[model samples]
Target: MAGSSLMKSRFESFICDANESVAIQLVCSDNELDNEPHNHAIKEFNPEFSHQLFGDNESIFGYSDLRVKLYYSSAKLNCFLSIGFTDKVTKDETNGIEADDVVDTIRQKLSLKLCSSMDEFRSLLSKESQFIPYGKLMDSFSIDWKTDEKQTKRHFEIYSADILVPGFDAYHQRMQTFLWWLIDAASYIDADDERWQYFVVYEKRSPNGLSNGHLHSDAHNTYCFVGYATVYRYYAYPQRIRPRISQFLVLPPFQKCGLGTRLLHTIYDFYVTDTAVFDITVEDPSDNFTRVRDFVDSKNCQKLNAFSVDKLKLGWNEDMATEAQTRLKINKRQARRVYEILRFRCTDRSNADEYKAFRLGVKQRLNAPNQKQILDYQKLEKLKKFPEQELAFIRQTTIPALEVRLDLLDKQYKELEEEYQHIVERLAES
Candidate 1:
């Protein structure tokens, strides 16, 4: 007990030192290390150095000078620390150490045995009990689904924004670090703001009922972290609430497992079921997110009576638009997009007559503005100095202009058709 306390004090002191750290490394007890002692040849410390020593999402892909190695037990909370020169600057003279001597000069520090495993490490770092469920009860709020790769079940849960602010805990703080790794120009959240909501996906595991040689039946179930998203609820004019997804991330390990689509669908389900929500929205969605949303929205709309293939053939109408907004919480513009994509999915591309009909249907929507321009030109043609020649010139320029616009629209339709085809294939699997 005395030794554990001493280790905790040492670890805290090391963290408080505010030394010029370059990078940090973590290893389990099973990891091998050289027996050579750490040399302390270079001692200059910079207090303001925070050069994202961890790689993009903790991969150590970027440049970093100093390195901190964390050694922990494989399944226990035991951890030891050491400061070393990263491989990037092992020989750089700006750091005031000879290339080969840097590794020899590194120093070892405090060792801590607080929690067990990486999951427990995150639990300790979280400030709110709701965000970090370890050692806490949270059986009622979880939703589970199976992953495509491992075929293993994963769970997701929603939490109010209050749990992330003011005095954020260690686990939440650590998880927040992922934003820097995954997002561009990312910043930490204002925990005091009640407008944010979080959705987290994790792997649920049963507890072994044993802790440090003691058995406790009430030990909370373990939730191995996967990914999470942040959402902000805005009060639109009138009685509408617009929930914008501020951030969405799926860790690299879980990518391509259909988890992203599942997460998106789950979030939609949450909002669609709410009585106060006006329409769902997204904040600066990436191209990848836009595609996923296209698929999810299209699939859901297909189940509605208003978006049937027969209705889709008749094209987007007030009834289809209204049902999408009221039943699916989709905005009008996006609802129209989904309607077109679904319509293209049912199009018979191999049949020349059917294909021509599909093309004409899309072209008609694209021609509306061009048709208006032609009418305006016709009205002004009679007033020109040489009405006959001016009218001829206008016809010459306008017809080709319309053709160019149609060409561009055709390209857009083809690209959208390909995307819709992919979505349809995925839907078939589901």
Candidate 2:
């Protein structure tokens, strides 16, 4: 039967019929039902659970009982739960398992755990297939970046310098949303001035067009660069700098293909060789950045400091700094190391230390008579260098009045203390 032409033809016909019928049913059912209900059910199955179980081949189906059967009838495959026990099963209706049968079994098993609509089931199956072996698929579909570098430049212009171009606002906004989805979190990508300055690589369509669909889109086409160093500058000097990058986004359909790597390499190459950007810094560790980090490392790009702007910003607050100092032991040596890594110069280390000590001392002396003197001295020193107009304004302000009252109170208390000291001395003499 396996070798017979008639049997082979019949089997082929059955497969074609089953595929067409099932495809039609799935499409029709998908349109009728909403996927949201099943999404919540699937969420119960931890998003990472599939990754753990399947290890890339996440598309799985299972059944509760082995009695469930799948059959291809009238060119369409259908699943049914066994109704009753039978003494003997007929040869024509033999209980056999196929690949599809296994899938059906897994689906049934999943359905028992969650209330999933037909649409949701279909959607899940489709998505499951997409992510399964995505890395392998990407590797298989890899494109040579060098082969396309010149072609890409000739066919599609690659910009090494930061150009002032229009219509980037829309692209940047779109890319922000796309990157957020890819990274699995909402992150702002600012294109402010300071950040824009460091963005070296950019791409736009030439008068002709790109050979690859990944390079240029018919609707919206722009490319931008993003690195850790660029982000750090923005965070550090938010008031002084604006962020900038190419607006080109790697769409969902285009991802997992080597296009992402190619684009990134193209940009990197442009920076290193074409643009002469010697020092390139990426925020994420090589392992975490995945392909981008790998490409950079392959290119012999050096890894700089592992600086986190959020940590530096946290160090700005006194309480937070104290807490961090206590928890992390951010002493003078650590502070100096951080400053050296960040390239910040401390001109007056002793003065800064003294100021810190003075502040702490003032806090300790809050109830003392000299508290007024300490406060007045600090305030007067701060105001002494002010311009004439500012000094006059300060004199007119309530600050001056408060200072005068505090000074008078301090002098009167001092006079009383002196008199008391004289009386003590006279008593001692007697």
How well does candidate 2 match the true structure in TM-score terms? 0.26
lDDT of each residue in 183-211, candidate 2, tens digit only: 33324545555335222222222112222
Where does the lowest 10-residue lDDT sum fall in candidate 2?
Answer: 131-140
- Give the whole-model CA lDDT for all candidates, comma-separated: 0.57, 0.31
Error of 1 at 110 (Å): 23
Q: How many clashes does each candidate structure show, in the order listed?
A: 19, 18
For model 1, how does the per-residue alpha-carbon lDDT over 243-319 read when each residue is reduced to its tens digit?
98888877654566666787787678768889899888888887788888888898899999999989888877988
Model 1 accuracy (lDDT, Cα): 0.57
User: For all the candidates, what are their Cα RMSDs to the real structure?
Assistant: 12.8, 25.1
After superposing candidate 2, which stretches have Cα over 4 Å from the reference? 1-163, 197-249, 273-278, 285-288, 299-430
Best candidate according to TM-score: 1
Off by over 4 Å in 1: 1-161, 164-173, 207-220, 363-404
| lDDT at 67, model 1 | 57
